[model samples]
Target chain A: MNDQRPRILLADDEKAITSNLAPFLERGGFSVTVAADGQAALDGIAALHPDLVILDVLMPRLDGREVLRRLRRAGNWIPVILLTQVGEAAERALALEEGADDYLNKPFDPSELVARIRSVLRRVTPGQPPLASAWQLACPPEAPGQPALALDRRSRRVSLDGRTLDLTPKAVALLEYMLTHPGELLSRERLLDAVWGWDYPAGTRTVDTRMAELRRALGDDPARPRFIETLPGEGYRFVARVVAA
Target chain B: MKITWRDLLLAALPAALAGVAATVLRLSLGRLAVLLLRADIGTALVLLGSSLSLFLLVYLGARRAGIARSRAAIERHDRESGEARRRFIHRLDHELKNPLTALRAALANLQLALSESDRAQRVGDVRLQAERIGRLVADLRKLSELEERPIEQLPVDLPGLLEEVVEAARSNPAYAGRELRLVVSQVPWKLPPAVGDRDLLALAFYNLVENALKFTKAHDPVEVRASEDGRALIVEVADRGPGIPAEDQPRIFEELYRGANARGFEGSGLGLSLVRMIVARHAGSVSVRSRPGQGTVFTVRLPFDARDRAPVPAAG
Candidate 1:
């Protein structure tokens, strides 16, 4: 069994908050790094290259927004979740638009943050296959006169109707998971954990975006989905009969 | 009594008009002069009486109108001020009661048989409540002093005072994540000394900065800028946060008048009122410009002491 754990960078200027939260996160199976201020947070991100970053919107020196802005500008797409105060809906919206993975208001239950972390990790981290045999069984040979979707696990590629789809690795991983599951009603959390990894803190909006991108690539409509069927608030379903090619 | 020429003219004008009317009637009826004169005289007398009555009526009406207008203005002012005083009292009671209740509850809880950690936490709560009460009382006292007491004017170093206030705010744990920056120009220009009590002015600046921090995000920078505008020193505290709503701006300086957006935030609402009071005492003015989404800028302008005319050089 692998002993590796996902690394989380927790940035807040409040010492009391970090001191209290870091241990809880560590107990939840994450290796946590604490940054005292915005500048420290940015420096930590550069040095640590952590799997996920939890940022407080208000921090001394650079602040969370500036840090996020710099990170995005530098093309660092590490999963980020913002910790904001209550009644900051406008700021929360701005954060999301600026590519923040998710946001949680302060005075939140620690358990809720842990749950979000798990869900986000699942969506962001590409889960490792257990065995080579399991990889081979991921997709089987295609049947005659059927529209088929094939996933080449080795190449991290997905092909539909013998035509290669230009998909990001994350998108391909998502497609592979949905195809493998077939008729199962996969919840967003399940998809997030299964495809992204166990500890990613990306929100359902992230899942929604990836789903939209995948649908566009597969030439599927959300209103009348051919392959990916959205269950609105519940989750998504792959209705297409995917055969092994 | 000494009558002026104007008063004599006013008295004679009616009689003159009556005489002129009588002459016209007598001339028109030349053959029947005596009978026409008698009738014309009677007509003139009636006309004079009516004209005098009308003049008196207009003069009295004009005086009454003037009195009524002033009376209405006085009554309106009294009503408004009375309502304002009532609101101030009501808010004071409410604000004071909150901490008092908390303190009582904490005291009661302290009598319970609890663990060491729980007892310590309860003690902390009690201390916090006590501190809140102290702050409320202190603010009320300061507000009254600012309103009633005469400010002891001195040549105050505007930049130094602001730096001290900002530094104090930066060190406060409550404002831990917020950035407090003093925005200065590349040219190190000297700022004229504002004529005010140093301690009171510092308190005003501190309150403004603290208020800014309360509204702004922890990461947002609260910039304090000071410049000389001729004879006045203009100090502005700007924040990048959700601004005061249009409707809230006018009444924000009123005692205990909180804004619509101030619901979730913790404040006594006495800060700005105190600032306004202090500035007014120093013969200065404070105003705010804010838009809903953009941000807020609170500008305080105080006159420089004419006695200290020499521009003091900026300390390196």
Candidate 2:
């Protein structure tokens, strides 16, 4: 294992940003590799197993969100910094819940990007136990027949109360995040940074758009929400009490 | 459908003329001869003349009536158009109010937060609010320009125009709060020297850059770059952030169409609309390519021929 320099994988479709950022990170004393899209980033990460991964939220042939999911599923504990554009607060929260270390919004200063990369790297470096001890705790699977979450990994299908629910990829990701947090209040900005990744070029209304869709799929009303509740000037929280079967 | 005063006058004209003419004719002919002729051809001639005179009078009355109705129709159309204009003005005023209100609030917050260490933080709030107002103003300007004098054909120095635009955008009161980076690529530049009015074209590019920077988060660097692609000059402003939704791509440049993702982002939703209008005015075009989770790339293509050169005054 090369301990001389921390290796970071930076992936984005834009050549200018990627090229400009690579040198900036190198100046910050981090070894960086540029990937054009999500799949390429994933392939690069698999080959390199870098100390940190900086991924753009939007990409072709599989988005950043899906790539992050695969990374978690593979049990790769590599610290990641997701870049999102505006309006991705809710999505950012989902990424955090899925175990991403940090995130940033696009048009971000190269210096700040380096700073955040350092922050995440410091938290989860090799031979150093991560600072947040809660993440280290192994969670037991849910008990049987107690509000069971029947998720079919192959079909991307979900059901609650014997009724099938059709939710968008982003909404499903949010639900999964909320389920993991279970009663924790998630701010809109934080959520956006989590799911969408930094530089997910949008405004705050992306959360509202995906939330509205989620509510429609879950048979929840915005005026009188059952599962997801608003925090009033802060963000949203998933309030449902569940015990997996 | 209601009857007018002209209709009444038309109805009365024929009868009035016929009564006066008949009385005069009766006075000319003596009663004895008239009584003898009344039994023969004289009576037939008088009856025929009276009927023919009445027919002519009725025809004149009907023509006058038709003219009157048409005049009323024109008046009605004018009134409808006036109302429509008033409604449009009302809508414009309503749109203008939101940004102004936000700007006021942001300024107030800045004044309050001045003593604190987070004054720098509050600066962003103030700047964002101001951007909201700037966007609204840009939208209004665009509406007025497109409606009034439209630019048709003019040569443009793409690089010079871009530089001026970036400078204007960065200097804007709303945008002065953030760090702005303008990158220009050096190539054998081909530009028609005597392009359009530097002011109007500069304003168009300024609006586009302002939008890119406005939509970006604070503390982040907003990028402005220009490069020539084949026969077209391509200017792009790309941010590394959450991009616009696929559904909104088509409508982003439409007047008054705010995307679902733009809530809490200070904008009157007219920046892109204005950009399109200005580009179209110069015989150029603008387009957006975006993905939901990725950033957006806004492209402005201005066609130019190096041979067409005219020395126009630079913008003051």
Candidate 3:
């Protein structure tokens, strides 16, 4: 039998970060190409024609944003995931607007990146409906007088009642997943597996942190939530109406 | 000795009154005077003596009023400076006590027989605490020097200096996952040079960026943007986080004033104060605009050419 694995180009100036992250990506079953700077990253992406790119926001020469800008200007639609430092929400949004597929803040658990990579790949692959279309199908249409949460996949933004909510990518992802499967009981393990991926450390509070942040952004009280409801020993449920616009 | 018309009038009024009284006495006791001494010499002598006494009284009264006014002024000055000194000492104690307490606790934790990971983490905490203490001391020293020492101003590249500050912030491990962006709105090639101490200006920019990052989340980007504002260059560090409360905004630049929302954050509360001090030392001014739950923008306006401006006077 024949095996074809997805290719990923990892561009970062820090050797310590790339060296560690490259091996992790390879172990997760992707052909990884390393670029030490922005120029090299652009060269590597063109030369390798990788399926996806993980670019660091702060890089020498061209920088991650510039690289992404150039790639999009060249009309390359390959999915790109930005590796950003913390406190860069605006940069993340800008990158997404510049055609980046996703972004993960630095000091991130490598497993989360892997999950994002697979998820983005699945959306871009030939056979499957894109993630956005799938999300739309799962979401209800906007109705008057009812509180609605809408996630714009293209911009990577979440809005409630026409107001853009300030939510971290993780929180946004969690809310998106819950919105897609409204009223379904999602256990902690299942949510973790779906959101953080399988390699994430067990007993880590990744889900809880994301959930708490999501709840806070929604203004949903834990005890009496209008959107997310905690089921005691079970995971959580999105009780509010989710609309796709 | 150079008496004015008013002084002359004051001096003459007493003598004139004494003269009038003496004349009256002379007229009334003319018979008695004629009978006793056969002259008005006694009345003239009494009048002269009374004039001297009244003049002396007026002079003494004026001197006493002047002394009282000077004493009140001195007391006010003393009270104001004393209050300021007390506030400064209180802030210093609070800032120092924080790091000292954290360092002590970290050290005590290190002494425990813990696992390798726990030990390493404890050691990291101790190092961080120590660094915090070092930073506090360094900031205090810099602030004092800024107040006392005259800075060595030189032609410094404003954009390059901002880039350096952003680079330093990027390399900070504590903000490893934090995003810092330097947006130079001016023409890169034609950017004007600012006259300042490179190190001090860089420190001011760094402190502003650091302060923004401290209040914001890892996902929020702390934007450091610089543009030319007429003859002055304006650098703004903006953050989209929980903004400063209206009441806190006024005192945010005050030394050791932590905002109401700053609880649980690891800060010495000297960052903004130091930023203001550094900027002022460069003959610049720093101001902040923030709305609660919206965000904050700290703007530092520096003259493009501060070479001709006088050095900021030392704070008393």
Candidate 4:
């Protein structure tokens, strides 16, 4: 692997997956190191110290989950991305809790995996702290007079007027993306691509339905303006004034 | 066998002798002793013994005559009740099927008589009603079948089954504008044959997937997915529609039941019943988890195979 280019350690038991991903990541301008199994990936990690590691959940000789547990236990805060075979939320949360930086489900689009890798790499560079740790992923901070919206990154929860909002998984993803890019008028297409994986259709009513659900969850009147403002022809924008915490 | 004077005299001799002895003893004893052994007590005791003997003799003769007749009557009654139950179910099944079959025939005839302009509308209505009948017949058959037979199964590829169901649903205009997605791991390995009756399993999955697509709004994607969890294969049909009401979850799988929100929706209320029957026949179980408006997930778990009784090792 080249020293200057960001190195990603890819570990999956299946050769086809790693092989398929190699060209895709190389095209995206990243140095890729492939490991056939979990133990090999961990050994490579200790030696090579790659910028990111994408681990598969099912593998012989130290499974992905155990690998993650050990790495985190060793205080190696190397950003890790878990590859899940099933898109089960509980399993994904378990991986995240075990110190995985992010995860992508199998049969995932190459572009989406690369995007997540970039997102994690951008957050946890050596010189800088993780942006997700510094800022709330779901909502802005709402102290005494700070802001109307407060987001709790660790919990993936949002709050308004001191009341917590219960949002679904997809709703949280969309909200997190919106919070990361505050004040930009994000088009529906762009928002769909960024939040929902690239595999989802571009023009889908799912976004509209979810936004309606989000508005309902946020206690905002759909007919009137509140935290989220609809741009009519444009997409939704988070317009609440941020009060400094 | 003929009674003679000599035999009568012999029978009376013992009683006469005992009477004489009692008289002598009464005379010889003192008044206090005679009073203590009262004369009426002996006579009452003799009468009580004779009556008990007579009662036993009469009872045994009557029991011998009545037992066989009573046993036959009870057995006949039991057989009659069982026959009645069978006849009732048979009649109900036949009665329920007759009108639907008649309507289907009528529709077919109408289709022949009608020209191209009205043919499409008539044919579509016919198909919808025919499906309703098919669902009803399936329910009745399942209700009866599950009571008697277990699944006789061959290996079924679930993905292939799902593809056929989705294709069938798509062709129906009622499912227009909805996106149906079949999401499975690309592992490409087939599930160990879940020994299950193919026709019954197909009906169950078709009902679940079709129902999911129907409840969802236009253009909303309904996802059907399968995955291995331990030794069980879990197949789920999930809909992002207004989910079943919480109060209805426990009872939705019941026969001829529809949730309060489902009252106005177009359904026969037999879809879930048929699904449950089929699952039960395959030695499997089904459950639903949902909150109103969040969407619902119906999960079915079937054993992997006979030899693999132990739970499949959890994903390493």
**Measured against the native two-chain assembly using Cα atoms, what DockQ does each of the candidate structures obtain, in the order listed?**
0.01, 0.01, 0.01, 0.01
lDDT of 1 by residue, B101-172 (tens): 988898888889389988998899998877677556656655664565445566777887787778778767
Q: How well docked is model 1, in DockQ terms?
A: 0.01
Q: Comparing 1 and 4 by lDDT, which wins?
A: 1
Candidate 2: which stretches are off by over 4 Å? A1-245, B1-141, B150-154, B172-179, B188-194, B306-316
Among all candidates shown, the one with the greatest lDDT: 1
Instruction: Give TM per candidate.
Output: 0.45, 0.32, 0.40, 0.39
User: lDDT, candidate 2, residue B222?
Assistant: 70
Residue B117 local lDDT, model 1: 84
The weakest ten consecutive residues by lDDT in model 1 chain B span: B26-35
Cα lDDT of model 3 by residue, B199-249, tens digit: 567667877888788788888878999887456778999999889999988
Q: What docking tier does model 2 reach?
A: incorrect
lDDT of 4 at B213: 78
Q: Could you give the interface RMSD of each candidate, to one decimal?
A: 24.0, 16.1, 19.9, 16.4
Q: What is each candidate's fraction of native interface contacts (fnat)? A: 0.00, 0.00, 0.00, 0.00
Q: Which sequence of candidate numbers ranks them by lDDT, best first?
A: 1, 3, 4, 2
TM-score, chain B only, every model? 0.75, 0.52, 0.65, 0.56
Full candidate order by TM-score, most accurate first: 1, 3, 4, 2
B1-316: candidate 4 lDDT, tens digit per residue: 2355754554455445555555544444444355446765665555555555555555554454456445655676788677756755664565456547767776877758657766776666776666556546545544664556434455666676667666667767887667888887546455555666544566688788888877778866788888776668889999888898889898788666667877657655667876887787788899999878779899998877675343457576
